[model samples]
Target: MTEQKRPPRAIGASGLSCFPIGLGCASLSGSYGPSDDDNALRVLHEARARGVTMFDTSDKYGNGHNEELLARAFGNARNSVLIASKFGNMAGKDGKVADNNPETIKAFCEASLERLKSDCIDLYYIHRIDPAVAIEDTIGAMSRLVEQGKVRALGICEVNPTTLRRAHKVHPIAAIQSEYSILYRAEAEDVLQTTRELGVAFVAYAPLGRGLLTGAVQPGSLGDKDERLRHPRFSAENLPKNLELAQAVQQVATERGCTAGQVSLAWLLAQGEDIIPIPGTKTLSRLVENIEAASIILSDAEIGFIASSIPPDAAAGLRYRAEHMKNMYL
Candidate 1:
């Protein structure tokens, strides 16, 4: 919809590249709320048609329905684009968020490859770290996948500097996927410093602050099945405060002649060439708006103004709920 677009961004030194903003496919599997399979396929097809080169997914999304959806949508064209999926991030009966067992890595990759219907995955990641397992052991297992030619590159999600360094020692980590946006850069900035030093690309998920920066998700508009209802950032107590802070983006959008979501995404793009924002949407118009965000180039002054408008620690609530917060950034 926009008249401008940026060049392809590289993923570390992995010899792979993608469009500036990619598609985050979690919502397609009904992570946020209820999703229709027919519409989900349409959205994936539209994203590919609109030049979204990267499609981020996880084995945990809809119990692996998401990968199947991608396979069905792309079919013969699956290899043309990048599909970055993850494993061991599912919640167990104990309510923990990881299962990075070295023993099961092969089985997971084999199953993911089967579900993806692809001979080799463009990128693979550890959805989350299992504290009980040694980082070296898990990464070492992943590195073997590369040796066997099953994966093109490796990545880690929700990682810290120390853990990243350890993982890199085992293998060259091409990218780091984390929550990043104007409203939630405290962790992203900290991780960016290390990623830049290590020459690792940063894949930013939740670039729109879980739709808060879009100025459309009202307080009571979330469906009963929506997962945001359980997030602290979307709590009845914290939602208003966070939305108030997000108004700064809306003001900038008004001045810049674009949607608030565009400003939010453009601000992320302004962060650096290594940063790629993957904002997701089930609606076609919103998807187009996200893709067009790559075209927006903010001035130096505007970028600074937007950053100061929402301080690093100004957000009122935690990224995840109290229980899940314990496992992030490890």
Candidate 2:
């Protein structure tokens, strides 16, 4: 695949710009399967060479191994890249899934900075909203990071419009990360509306539906140890029906003269400039394919057809398991 020549996309009003497509570094730390350190470094370097400035990871990913990996890849040329890492998802002393205590936020930032080996994080996000904590208190603490120059911008993941509005008032949230794809559009479209109203950018994670829209991962094809196996979207009853939705993408790809993954990404790029998709990959070829997707502009008619092919709720299963659903989109 060839490199794209598009201009950088801005992250809200934070004065930060990056390639339209960023690299989500979760898989590098074994989110899906085992990974090699040297091979992961090659992929990161190749992404940088292809103009992907934004590298997204989380402290909970591989227990901070992901951040340390980025530190090794871009420690010498930090200015050339945008490091977007998250906190609040890792379990704290109480054994909870989220930890958004104001006092802990600063300590989390310190630990992430140490792992990343960087002076300041380009974009710091609350990986998950803690229902027990007020959004204002969380954002208020994050704002102080901006004041102290420890973080350049703030973001939140799996946020709803009301929580997003409340958080924005406490501190300007530059972005919101969430699972957004053609198969799952209900919440993300609602989010786009609020983000447009507030000037907050949408960082789309799992833009490919965790590979359902990629056309490569078929029903029952995932390895036993793959984390995606735990997601309800890939369940025994759901995978077949979901793959059927992906077939729609394959049809569009055929008409567009590109791969299914490229067509899926191109349709997303056509949504709006404020939406940025971070599709993670462990392969060099896929990194190039995703970067090239930024340049494939679909006609309005094609975009509409793709959207209609897979309706908002066409997805077969929940975004996550029943036990974990309560914590998402809070």
How accurate locally, in lDDT, is each candidate? 0.91, 0.91
Model 2, global lDDT: 0.91
Q: Compared with the true structure, what per-residue lDDT tens digits does model 2 show for residues 5-97?
A: 567889999999899999999999999989889999999999999889999999999999999999999989889999999999997667898
What are the TM-scores, per candidate, against the unseen true structure?
A: 0.97, 0.98
* Worst lDDT 10-window in candidate 1: 1-10
Clashing pairs in 1: none
- In model 1, which regions exceed 4 Å deviation? 1-4, 92-96
Error of 1 at 293 (Å): 0.6
Candidate 2 clash pair list:
none
Q: lDDT tens digits, residues 138-188, model 1?
A: 999999999999999999999999999999989999999999988888988
